[model samples]
Target: MNVAASGTALKRLRRSARLIVLAPGPRVLMFRYDIPGRDPFWVTAGGECEPGESFEQAARRELFEETGITAEPGEQIARTTPEFVTPEGEPVRADERYFIVRVDSPDIDTSRQTDLEQAWMNEHRWFALDELDDWHEALYPETLRSLIEEHTA
Candidate 1:
């Protein structure tokens, strides 16, 4: 478990679970996000863990909540704890865990998004591995590409 909090002073810890959801085309799912003055970027789908929820459970719930996609969240492939200010300027400490799930192509459903997600997510795309190399500066969990390669290898 990891803890993350954002603010000038870090006090609160938020644990989150993320998914590296992949389709048959070997493409990875990502959300386009824009943070005010910052350039747009991409992120894997996920959200904070609810109280008393295990990481795996949170991963499953987050996937469904964010994309209306359902699948058994497989093994945890990576974990990181990072602290940053949210786009809303709230300081947050995030304990992020990444899980891998593979599925056939499916249409995404976003009607279930939380308000925060509705505001932050601008669009969604399935990215080819080579495309990721060009998106390094715009990818969250910056080590995402290497992590995927490492685990898949």
Candidate 2:
């Protein structure tokens, strides 16, 4: 590992803001990414927080950037600290926070997705909260079900 000019190692922590967008049918927005020869996984809409941006600001920006949907950020429902390696093979510890937003429509536009996001985005769908259990245990937050129930109930 190389040290920085200040004699500090490079930071590996990434702060992200995500949203759980709910629609009129009480369904939540989710997206699936599948690669050939690998299991499919789902994720909510959001991305890394930009410099000089607050978590809420990042959530709003990413919600639009990733899904072309816009809504007011509600309660912060969950937070997690997880470490993983990026596609570029660099280790990253993610400080991810999730917020809830209810919307009237589910329409999405893909024109805004960054090249990196477009690479992994396969399809998007709206899922009924009751059916979330059938998706198994592969959701990004893993604790999503409980988080939803906590805030909505």
TM-score (all chains, Cα) for each model: 0.87, 0.84
Query: Candidate 2: misplaced stretches above 4 Å?
Result: 2-11, 35-38
- Clash statistics: count for each candidate: 8, 0
lDDT of 1: 0.84
Query: What are the per-residue Cα lDDT tens digits for candidate 2 across 13-104?
Result: 88999898888767888878664555678888887899989899999899888877777787677899988655445678799999998887
Judge candidate 2 at residue 44 and give its lDDT. Answer: 85
Give the total clashing residue pairs for model 2. Answer: 0
Candidate of highest lDDT:
1
On the 0 to 100 scale, the lDDT of residue 28 in model 1 is: 88
List of clashing residue pairs for candidate 1: 4-93, 4-94, 5-92, 5-93, 6-91, 6-92, 6-93, 7-91
lDDT measured at residue 81 in model 2 versus the true structure, 0 to 100: 91
- RMSD (CA, Å), each prediction: 4.1, 3.5
